[model samples]
Target: MFAVPALSGADDGSWMEVRSADSRECIMAEQRDERLGRRRLHLRLRFLAGESTGSYVTRLAARNNLPVEGVLRSMGIGPMLPVEPQYTEMYLSRYARERLANLAGYTVAEMQKRLVGLRDEFLMSDGDKDDWEWPWDARAGYIVQACSLCAAQRGTRSPAWLILPDPWHVCLRHHRWTDNSRSTQHPYIDLSNLKDVVRAQQRLNRLGKHLGPAARWVFADACSILVRSGYLEDPARTEEWAALAKQLGEQRVRPLAQLSRLSLLTQDLAWLEVRRLYGELGQADYREWLERATRRHGFTFARPLKEWHSQHQPLSRGIPELFSDQSPPSNVVRRATGHELPSCLAAVEELSCLPWVRLPNTMDRLFL
Candidate 1:
């Protein structure tokens, strides 16, 4: 049996007894909580070691007579080991926590207790610890990796994938915000050039804090819809669009904007849209929302709803799902920028949030 080395400078001290057998060096891990529901687990190991973490876990498992998965699970790491670690290390989703018990001197249980206490880390509920698996299920969950700025500041490269209680789009510390881009990853957009957009993000944060999670979820949903409505381009299109644009700028109109745009009045507009959607969505059905979205985008589906796939499906997903707690997809998120938007989202927020209200009970009958 391979024996763990005895501690030299105080058994449970911050500094551990490092015992190297050839090129394999002992890696240490500890949990650091910087935010709610997303504490970071730092693994202090010579990543230069020739072997993969999975190989190390497998070797340890072979040495200890425990299954490789058991070794990882005990450390709060992943289950099915991967040959190479994925880039999604920032959040709770990554699961490679086993390195914390590097010393053979301590038991796995003891090391976990140490991890829980090290950062004064605790969430309201740790409930149903995640089972790390491939092909993640989208209906019930989401995975957000760590903020780039946070990882860079801390010099951590292997951040875990985490399931945040609410969707967060930026690292306020770095003043960098991100969501889905035109590509796969959530690339950070430096907000340094736009002071107003920065204020807008801050206001959104405050709105979330003041109203609580459910309300914030509703508001983000509203923002996503408003951005998609193309009302931002509507003012340039027709007299009807121009009239509404004039009305939005009028003193009598209300201010409304969300993740799509940031302004002094972002908070009020978010709140307004949230209430607006909650009421309208509560009363409206999903079918109408889908059909109206098609008309708004200046297109209509040629086939039946169920037969509609990629092209038409994009227009159909947000409204019904918005009322639910689940996070919306990339199409809905508007990464704030200097681009001009509607003078007031008040005119368009609800139009996007619940377009079903404006539509007739059926699709246009033969253009009659």
Candidate 2:
């Protein structure tokens, strides 16, 4: 029997009593909730590197942050015990949970019940036992973890549980209607959690600042948001974009041309900028388009520094030499210096191979 320390600060509190040595009672309420089928328990814990009891307590705590004495007081745990403290602190996950629970001063059972309550309120309702896990299953865990990862990577407060996990999965039903990326995760419930996931996705996209797939995702998500919010009708904007994309693909025209035409038609200035920044257009073509855009729609021509850099940056800089062939690099057409390089050219030395991709008569290496 181990004794928990008495509280130094005196104040009337409701959770200070437990029966002192009953493991079952420590989380009995949660077990009951699980048995009742109202909620499912997910315990997250971090334990001291190699302690047993500490590990167990950590597990319990992770499931719900509960104070040690409060957890044992009503449970009849002894005030003092003969067990070595080191022996109790060895389970990794278990200790993690216990630490969480202790910090929050909540017993396993109480936290379980609360989670059940949350499920009842937030999860989708289905009439079957197995089907009832909507929006909060293992996939939900993946989404949450994804959110955590995005938060760590991007430093945003977006909800992770609604977005797809690594490898970027999406439901066919949801993604097929538009240009959104397809995810491999199935049986998605696009309930409230999806909003949080989008927030995280948007945050990460912003952090990426129009680089790699991050910029693409941001663009896609913005379109999706407009469609979902009824600002743009379903299949209308996407339909228009698709139609233009198809026309361009059939004609072997560039993607920017397609995007710019669609943006002009849709009255979305942002998309027009997207087309300009991501189109890999030549300086002459860009100037022509800028003039055309301003004449047709009174659009401004200022380029943000980040957007300019993304459009004009060299593709061979950070891209691994091996994978550069799989996709055409964005920096092939340098917007800033009006210099264009061969699409596959990796070095200034390669410029001599194809003089047409460079200035008409000059052989100097041009920085974009």
Candidate 3:
């Protein structure tokens, strides 16, 4: 039988619940280390989905009324110092992961599913001790709070934090706006009154699913256009977001609140670019289409159309080069030369250098 360590705290019994019904067998068969006298904690906390390993440790410490450092030490994490899960990440060594999984009454596979930092790519195999570390470059991603309502439903007393990826700041279920900043003061903004923002998140989800890898390029290009046009900072362009901020009692609009508008604008711009490239629209025709598309999406370009063309001249000039050496495959040629264009841009690597273009074989039907 596995030995279970007695926990010292006011009894709540919530942590005793198994994370999943299927994990019951795995929990029951947990083993003890006779030599080290290592055992599972009597209270086993549920891991929040997409939770950072550091955040899980924090919640575990809070639930058992133990110091965060103490919990890390118990999991064989050492040289223990203060751990700020919201602002930093913790990478677990292979051995340390085993010990932590044993302590928490979970199998390694079970922990991997819920802990974002516990993935194989993030794990530290050379070291024995788990340590707080970040492996990515300066601005890859950041940790943010998980949905509060979702946490409460999971029976957590303290807030749970998540290592959210780009284009995933909004919690569709709770209508909360989560951000990638280090500040803990306002981790999530309530978007109960902002139905447009909620709809925008849904649209973003669809765009991601529909376009696959190409969605990233579309989103980045859209953001660049908006920033260049001063839509984010210009008062005239930010009226909707400003009103949303005021309703939420914030001094200024949060950039994330404009995601809904951004999503629409992204779709418009992506569709226009595809049409300009594949339809072989003339310069004047392309300019007219660009004007109509931007106006339809409520974006007023700060610069003249000629200036914009000069900046993105490569997109207009590179078509002949793309097909010069070898003609595009029959299907692609048919789609491009036909009167009715395909709903989305074809997945081709040659166009990758251009803004809002997709990579090879990653295309799907876009709604627009």
Candidate 4:
């Protein structure tokens, strides 16, 4: 369950897993082909070998007296890979999969089943091979780091990184809807701030029971819109909530607080409103626009998203904007049939195999 150093390419990458065998802790070794030849890598690990939930990077950095990012680069994996771990599969070849299975004690059948399971989870067509890949879009658009609580349950504060394709605020078994990664830099938004949001998340999960994962994108966009309104508030739209924000101020409420307070029926109503109004929206591509818009206006996700969405209640009418704080034009068009056209909200002229993370830009800002 290590995020460590992963490599992403359209093709040509290999990886192996070495687990504790007794704990939830594990390590991943990755390799990518370079023009100079395959890059050699050996993360400095303290203690010859033992069962521990400590981060290999953290320990490796400690052993070699280097920062985690430097150690990752030494391994030929991008420093950002730890934050977006699953991108490794972008270049992970079939040969790599078979090799990894052999190392992890999983049979070929088991590995095939895992791949099949991921496909089923994403509802991708099975017959597409050379042309098939996980729809990294239609997802929360960030890597899933270790669950702090799950790790604590097993006795360690170190990260136990895992993949969460649609982390749409639903964790029935764990009874939590937020990412509890123990990252000091880009930790998750604290869920304890608004308990009602957790309930709303449960309702969203129920919506998923019928609508499936597509509903997740809908709800996520709604939250994104709600969060965006806090910074680039539309006066006409938020007239009703203006007083509330003044009353609660920035400290007393979260931009998403209103979404949490919505009744179950209203939550469904809002989801419907979002689906109908959105027409065609890509939740995967918007955060960059949101981040840039906020930065241009001198605000950060922490400032507004952590404060309040200008609108006190969900709108009954009007199509929601996927990547902007402003409303969409009246003549906005949609793709033919039921297909969704890609969005350039973030100016994706040069699309990379690894989708830039969709979280708020954390480059200089603390929350990406």
Candidate 5:
């Protein structure tokens, strides 16, 4: 068994209930050590006379670098502590196991929820399963953030039919997919069957509200592919709908309208302004055009992103290249892996050559 400091709040010496020291501080110090290229630390801490017993215990834990797992192990505990079932589980048990216990029945969504929740409980909590030490990965946070944005705007108004978190949203967010196998198991959503279709359609309906006139085709194409791939197998009449879908493609419907509006021509000040207006749309290229055009106008932009480039820069040296009144650049794509703009003008362009416009040095410096 691991050894832990026998610090306790209870008179009975039930020390395990005590929380560890400033977990944040300890983690920061560990980071600092790594930054300074140091490996091991020999830390010593002293308890103040005025410090509360709880604070003292926590300080001891931090000084020893003992984690929750370490403390639990020292107490001879197998950390797989079960928690009180949440409302969903209780309801599931009541309907699926108790009331309908005689019958073999379980909803797909309900089963999916239970599987994910249990897996998350294991990863997020100690063996006692009461406390959670959520691990953070820049990548996982990004995925979660994306999931949240998608979830938030889910039914509001978006062309994308469904942004279902693949297989396991929770596991992805926590970044412990290896320990949580449920994420990989339910990879593709089952949209072919009746019940699953209803669920899928419901999700699409929420997403459909956000669809711009131009984005309709992309949505249609995605649906067509799903059906053709047997993921959306429909037993009803099929050819009747196929012709209608073909006609839609011929008309350049759905995604065409939105696509047309996303012109690549950089010279169009109107387009550039539109891109920069929302601060959200038009992706990186929009920002690029905005910066170049704004700088060319002889006004240095500082409030948003600090920039020094002017019309003197190579990209801006010539007549501004107005975005062609056509489709968005074929290369301009939404993120596939992470949230970072992988290879946009913002990433590749140099800013060192650009001069920083400074105010005249004056009375402010004279005092020194």
Candidate 6:
């Protein structure tokens, strides 16, 4: 049995040493012993930013030329059933985490900070007890491949999968686009020919920064409005995304790529509508601004604007209630009360309940 070294504190960084064994001995011992409670692998792989636990483990196993299941099993971690080890997250107990950290030459704190999957509270068990089983039915987040160019820069030849929650997959540095598909077959779309899409992504990033927690809701609302207004389906507006699809050898334009453009065009107006809901702006002023904004994009909002007015006009304007036979529900009254804007949380809750509005699936899965 190989002697286990004491882990020093995270500050001094000396806890990484896993007994001074030579390469041949380390490999032989790791293979010979089914339980690697005190043994460490010969290679110490670095964790990529936002990389999932599955990705890190896969990389570690690949670097050391060992089976991923073997590495996992050796550390007292095993799946509840047969699973694609690289695609699913590994839930770990405290002792399992410490063993993993020791194997990867990272302190527990460092592992928690660097690995995105480690932060999930559901996957983490309490106490010093070493529970080795991964739940078979636990809902796993989608993991997609990171930018190939970025992965190459990090000295990895294999694709690095990440748990990215961003609505769009754009690598600004390489100008490559990947969709939020779980399938790994599609190649990254080149954004060099689609400059508008690139610019829209940049604007979307800025919008996220400006709106903070409300940004996803605001963007979803914008998408819903644009789809309802027929702006996103217009031939002229969709031509760019169609061209991009053709360039990328896809049969059809991805709805998300097209929606990204439409949302960017109308996000400012969506935010204005939010302000109007909060009573920050008068109904008349908001209508006027909406008219100007739509006109700038060569869209006349005559019918759509009128419909919007009828649906959302303040109750103080004496518009008849949708259900005139009875008093409005308290939630409806709360949402539509004049100059009494609902809090952000209330607004989100109300918007989510609207049957006609459809948010992107990604937003629904993640933020909602």
- Model 5, range 233-301, lDDT digits (tens) per residue? 222224533443364331211121211111111113233332332233334674476466445433422
What TM-score does candidate 2 reach?
0.21
Off by over 4 Å in 2: 1-161, 164-282, 292-368
For 1-368, candidate 2 gives per-residue lDDT tens digits of 33444444463343344344534222111111111212223444322111123223323433454444443332321232223221211111222233334443566444334332122222223332221111212221112112223223433232122211221222222321111111223112232433333444444444335343323332333333232233232222345445643543322112222233322322332333344444443556544654454455333222221233243323223222212336434464233223333321122222221121211112121111
List, residue by residue over 1-368, the lDDT tens digit for candidate 1.
Answer: 23333346654443333435344444232332222113212333222111222323333444455544444434442223232222111112222232334322333454334323111122112442442322222221123344554554433343322222222345567776433121123244455654555676677667755544334333434444333443332222445324533643321111112233323223433433344334442224344544553453343221221222121222212243444567344244332111112211112223233222121101111111
On lDDT, the leading prediction is 3
Structural RMSD, model 1: 17.5
What stretches of model 4 exceed 4 Å from their correct place? 1-91, 108-140, 152-157, 165-182, 185-193, 220-266, 269-368
Lowest lDDT sum, 10 consecutive residues, model 5, at 358-367
Residue 231's lDDT within candidate 2 is 27
lDDT of 2: 0.29
Task: For residue 333, give model 6's deviation from the true position in Å.
Answer: 18
| Root-mean-square deviation of candidate 6 | 11.6
* Candidate with more favorable, higher lDDT: 5 or 6: 6
Best by TM-score: 6
lDDT tens digits, residues 34-98, model 6? Answer: 34646668887866666767677767877888766556656653332334433445567666677
Clashes of 3: 0
- How far residue 45's Cα lies from its native spot in candidate 6, in Å, is 3.5
Best first by lDDT, ranked: 3, 6, 4, 1, 2, 5
* RMSD in Å for all candidates: 17.5, 21.1, 12.7, 15.6, 23.4, 11.6
Q: Runs in model 5 with CA error above 4 Å?
A: 1-11, 16-132, 137-203, 206-368
- The C-alpha local distance difference test score for the whole of candidate 5 amounts to 0.25
The TM-scores, one per candidate, come to 0.36, 0.21, 0.61, 0.38, 0.17, 0.62
lDDT of 4 by residue, 211-272 (tens): 43234343444344333445323322244345534553332223334544223423433344
Lowest lDDT 10-mer window, candidate 4? 344-353
Clash count of each predicted structure: 14, 68, 0, 3, 29, 0
